[model samples]
Target chain A: MNDGARLAAADRSARVRHADRAARFVADAGQTDWHDAVLWRIRGKRDAAAGRVEGWERLRALASEIKEHTLSRLDEYLAAFEEAATANGAQVHWAADADAHNRIVRDVLRARGVRRVVKSKSMLTEECGLNPYLEARGFEVVDTDLGERIVQLREEPPSHLVAPAIHVRKEEIAALFHEKLGTPADADDPRLLAAAMREDLRARFLAADAAITGVNFAVASTGALVLVTNEGNADLGAHLAPAHIACMGIEKLIPKPEHLGVFLRLLARSATGQPLSVYTSYFCRPPPGRELHIVLVDNGRSRRLAQPDFRAALKCIRCGACLNTCPVYRRSGGHSYGATPSGPIGAILAPGMDMKRYASLPFASSLCGSCSDVCPVKIDIHAQLHRWRQVAAREGYVAWPKRWGMRVAGWIVRSPRRYRLAGRLARAWLRHAPRRLRYGSWNAWGRARELPRVPDRSFGEWYAAERGKK
Target chain B: MKVGLFAPCYIDQFYPQAAVATLELLERLGCDVAYPRGQTCCGQPMANAGCAPAAEAAHRHVAACFEGFDYVVGPSGSCVLHLREHVEGAPDARYYELCQFLVEVLQVERLDAAFACRVGLHASCHGLRGLRLARASERQEPPFDYVAYLLDMVDGVERVPLDRPDECCGFGGMFAIEEEAVSVRMGADRLADHLRQRVEVITGTDMSCLMHLEGLIRRRNLPLRVLHVAEILNGSGEARNG
Candidate 1:
């Protein structure tokens, strides 16, 4: 296969083995606890900030409704966006899939004789493997976001959406910078490390020929692209370069410019607990003497939009609130997901992209519904996870052991007579079996938890006796 | 009210005291309670494992068992929610998790019950989010917990403050075995939260969660004990004879 296809296959394989990667991450108890604490703090901040809003739930409802309306008539909005963008002096490109998206990005860069590009944090590019695609085709691509830059320097994919290099410690970042950027060997301060990155990236930004950014919301009516970031990297990159490329999924459309108010009110508060991002840049028209291109990608999104049970997932605004609020993501770390958008949202979205590859993603959640609760668009995340599990099981993606085990369990619980017999046998075994036999390797539940004490009489038996007395 | 006491599978087999408490508690509240002999499981285990077809018979069995009762009440919120969501032909509105039934249906303002101990309330997920018995901690709504409200009316009962209120205990039916490592870690973390409060007892609406937490507590030989909300609300505190 081609280089891009080969890389995509390798990435899928890596994600398919999420269980092993997650186990290794969780093995480091101290790091896992630190990660959990950090993410939980973000969740707490989100809660406190969201609580202060007078009509937060109403805003979420309105946002959900707007997304639903837009998605139902996506073709119309896409046309309107393209028309308005063209009218506003911008070119529009539609990519059917990730490969096509990569090829389009390359063609755009090549036509402009661009050799260097600076990117502001765009998960769309990550999903499309645009960086590697461009790099293999002989173009220098620099990720300008602080967290993205850290991970890019390390030649690793981002671990979190809001904080891409959240898994890396300050000391590790210091070491990476020391090795790559010629910083002092013992430099461990955040300010110093950030300063070193800023100095190095400032040079790249000035010399870059093209700037690419991910669109947070693509307003169809005004033909404007909303880009939210704490760092002013998108502004610097998009303006300083001769060509600007803004990439967005087809589901990122809102019908009118006014609809942005509801989303803007919820996005930053849900993401990082800020009332608004430090920089909420709107790119309606390209800068003077610069070319503007909008690449609207529909890589497995149209298929997802047609699924009635899963259509709500498209309403995601990339707030990353669900990740912060997710217990599994906090403990296991983002890399455990082995996908671009890791955590609860990824679990739902990834399986739709490739079911056999991401079958384990849905099972990663405890289904506590915290992700759904904190979702600004009111996506029923946990319910969707449940639906995906059922789909996976039906499609025979579930392993043989689990499949037979659940089938056997289903049989036992269906009939009262067999149910009583199984309970009796289980209790008898627990009562008489030695500790070693009970807690052996074969028993997964017994590894960390003790067996419940077997009562001498079942509640059924006790209730029967109570009836006799009555 | 004629109440059908729907004992979930785990409570029927492993946690009989919780069921006994539910029975006696409902009786004390002046209801004629019936223990339907044909009732076995709520079909949640199968359905949650993504084998809903396997749970079909159990759903039919449960719906048939509780058909004639004026109201079907269960000690576990998780099972009640499963019935409401998954069971076809089942009376969704007639079925209630214990605390919800007492507070909403019975309009129980006070109970002649007493439990003299500081207990940490473990809010199980299905009850909190699915059943809406309590406002989830993640939401912006005004705080309300039917379980805690009922516990407050019982004399000599004090609730200890938890570090993270309303976190899942991680006993997600088949999830306890399917994803053992993460499940145990979550439960252990929850236990530590309660232990820090120096609680003598931890009580919740779901016994499945309690059983998992109790297993960890028992294995470590911790001083804490697990009790269903029914046992605390029942107030007898008498040890069951095996």
Candidate 2:
């Protein structure tokens, strides 16, 4: 194979080993602690915000029920949305996969003779590699969200959904701006850094011939696309350009416009603990004479939807609450997942898209169920992670050592006699074993955690002695 | 009531005192308890590791051991939960974590127990979320802690406050070995919360979690110790015998 192919293969292999990547991420103890604190603070803020609402659990149940209802009749809803959108003078296109989605977007841009395009924060685009695809086809695409723009400048995929560059320190951003955007040397002020980004993106927004944004919720009844953002970049990008293209996964549909009240309420508070995002823009039709297009992408979502056990993952609203609440995501960072969506949600979703390449993603969590409790849509995320582990094991993706070790343990544990014998031998060894031997490389449990002290007698023996005395 | 004591394998071998305390505590509560000899493990270690086929035999073994009991009680919430959820076609035996049985079944409103120390209550994840022994910190519900309620009944036992209560101590069965780095880091963070509260003792519903935290405390040589709630409750009370 060629150099590029070899490099890509190596990258894929590296991503498959999540434990190794997480270990490397945590090696910088200070940064891991800071990341943990940042995400945890967000989780705390979310809890405080959620507490103010009287019927928060009821709202979650309602949201979950609505999504379940929509998914059950997704085909009917999609057709209704397409008809409503077409009547509203917006073009509707369907893409079966990432390649089809990218091709459709490219085709639309080419037909309009659009040379430059500006995009707001859209994880779907990242998943589809839209910018790189367009760039290879000779279109200059710029990400307008400040976080996305920073990661764009650094040539890295987003490390977070809500805060794309959260992994990058302010000092690093300042250094990056100093080297690339010619900002003042050692300028670390947030206001100054944001101003620098604003100036750079403003020029691109004006020159761009078309705008692309992600749809947070697509109303089936009215065919209106809703975009929620704190920065209002989605509005600027979509309104400034003559042509607007909104890309969304088919699962982003709500049955009616009124359902927005419940989703919008849960979305912002769960995402960043805000009462509401600054911009909750609705687009039913384009500005007079400006073209509007909606590309509905499937790209493995339909396959995942068909899975009875994992279908609930499709109910996610891209709020990133699960990411904020996940302990594994907080310490390891999103980049470790090597996917667009990271955290507990990513662990469950990524395997459906590519099982072999993403097998290790499921086992990355501690199964604490925090993600499920914090989820706005009430997806059983940790339970899904456990389900995926079962899938991975059944499909022969588990390492042989673990498989065999569990088998041996199972055999011993099934019989009381063997279990007692094993316990006696293990206790004796633990009691008399040399410190060096007990703490050796083979003792993975002892590498970080100390071995528990073994008692001289088992509970069974002690119980027998107590009964004899009685 | 006839009670079967279901001691988890870890507690049976390494921390037998916890099981003994559980047995004595139940006896003090006027229940005839039996330590079924045919019992082994709850098969959680294998089940959680995605080896359910391997775990099936142990599940069957455990179900058979506790079949005839009126109520099966164990000190570990996680193990009890594992049995309830994973033991397929097992007899419909009534099982309870010790706190659940004491509070819900026995309806023990008061205890003649005492412990004169500020102890931090580590709400083990399984006991808190799995068994609903307490309202989780993430929810918007009214606060309630069964473990704290029981501990409150014990004289001279002062419960200390933690910054973030109900966080997992990260002894996730096989997860401790599979993801050792993250497991240890999470445990250390939980330890920091307890240490920050200046508590001399940390007690919880699950000894598995306490075992992990105690391991860390012992390794660091900190002036703190861990105990199962049963050990504390049983250590107190000179009550009349049944």
Candidate 3:
């Protein structure tokens, strides 16, 4: 590994690894959405100038209430959604895990006697591993979203929730396109690559027999689904396909469309600094005789809801704003999440699926609270992440070194004398210490950066000395 | 009033000047300051590393050291934030982050110091986010303006801003070393943004971040200097340091 890789790998097993990963949501997030954030800042400045836009805060409040009310009665709405969806002749399957979710999606495609399917940006599909499962099952799956298609062509995963292929620079994407489609075109100009992808995917979007897309918000009030996309690919995928399959976690349900305004106001503003996204499209009830499937996959969400504290995580709108604002996410990038939906929201949700599987995610924050501040509906992502760390510790999902380290620390903290003794010892240790202390992970941290030198006299000693004179 | 001046270990050693400024600032603000010398670390290194247990001793040492002081104030926000959040018994111990102590407790309106330059406010994540001295994110009503309020008081200072205000510089103690690339990238990004605004100097409460940025600033031979907000507020002006 290169120095950077070796250093990052050294941190892979640290207690703050999750915190480290979450901090960079900004740098790593919206790599594709760079265009999006600039757009939003422009929109934000303009909106600021536009005097008062009525129903903005009220809309977020209403959206928050809708989500709140929906989650409060989640069982009822989910049941209603399943009932309406099944009655409308759409197959509804529940998957407990990503494996199961992927299997169900693959099975749906096979059952329809379809071999090829086109897709838009859906975090659920990425989380469920659906495309690979289908591809592995001898079916072709084409990504319709320009970003998703670029990542698909490159055999990579989407880096951001909204913009899947964010990590690939346009030049690299141009090369990917150059390799995939004999379009020996210059890839550096994003406009050129996007236009090239649009041309190539337009044919696939038309020929694809089925389309699998992620539902942005599923309305229980009318069994209608909403999707907000900058690329407008979801609309195209749903519009052209004979079979439209919407994959969503159980938590996206809100009672009414009126409530979407609240989340919509905050979502685009926080995610991209846009006053609102370019399009917020809703699809309620399929056109007569079309096959529409809504897979209400649990994928550990039900289990998260089973616990009162974590169910709010399901309230996510998938704007990736939290990721964009996170310092950890900005630095580490998304691939380290090891699963889809990497970022602040991803850190909290990943722990639920397998606390150990994604144990390191909770430490992804500097505890900056930017994610919570930026969150449209106001999810306390950092707090939830801390709770996850406690849970992971309780669940025996700690590294041996950290556990022992904490155990030793726990003994010292609650006991004052031991704490003082420890300090004196450390001071003495530092007094004669060489340039470095090459023990454990400190070696790695002390390499690029030197530890702050310990003082000979503790603050308490100075206090005592000065206090005695007084 | 008797105040326990929490000189962060770093301040007590490498950056004694900040501690001295803090001590003088406290005294000028009308309080007898006591240096709690027995205190070494706030145990933040442990708590942040998810080894709060290990921090227990450090916490006990600090708490016991400052047990008698009517209030505790520190020049460093990271340390004071640690005192406020992670430090044992700090919540009830009448603790104040340095700027907070100046603005709220000591309640100093006019300071005997001035620097006539474009000052970029580097809100250390601890002071900016942890003690939440200024940030309210989005839900916060009208946003509590603490840091800006204090900086505005500085004479002839133009508070140059960054594109993403309140974003982290990625100096998460261990993080800078572990994810060195991302950490360095984040620091460089923040530094570049500050430079982009053409601020003559960058200042914040946490010297750790400032020190990291200072290293980068020196490496690039940038004209800008990094100063602790405490030093700036105390009128201890910064000159170019090699």
The TM-score values for the models, in the order shown, are 0.97, 0.97, 0.83
Please list all clashing residue pairs in model 1, or write none if there are none: none
Tell me the lDDT of candidate 1: 0.89
lDDT of 1 at A194: 93
Look at candidate 2 and give me any clashing residue pairs: none
Q: Rank the candidates by TM-score, best first.
A: 1, 2, 3
Estimate, for each residue in A331-431, the C-alpha lDDT of model 2 and write its tens digit.
Answer: 88998887779888988998998888898888898788888998999999988988898888899988989989899999999899999999999999999
Q: DockQ-based ranking, best first?
A: 1, 2, 3
TM-score of chain A of each: 0.97, 0.97, 0.85
Candidate 2 ranges with C-alpha deviation above 4 Å: A1-10, A13-15, A468-470, B90-93, B236-242
lDDT of 3: 0.71
Every candidate's CA RMSD: 2.0, 2.6, 5.5
Candidate 1 residue lDDT tens string, A1-470: 45545665577675465556666787788898899899999999999999999989888999899999999999999999999999999999999999999999999999999999999999999999898889878999999999999988877778898999999998999999999999999999999999999999999999999999999999999899999999999999999999999999999999998999999999999999999999999999976788999999999999988899999999999999999988778878888887889999999999998888898888887788989989999999999989898998999988888788878988887788998999899889989988899899998888878889899889998988877567
* Tens digits of per-residue lDDT for model 3, A303-336: 7777877877877888776766666665556765
Name the top TM-score candidate.
1
The global C-alpha lDDT for each of the candidates, from Candidate 1 onward, is 0.89, 0.89, 0.71
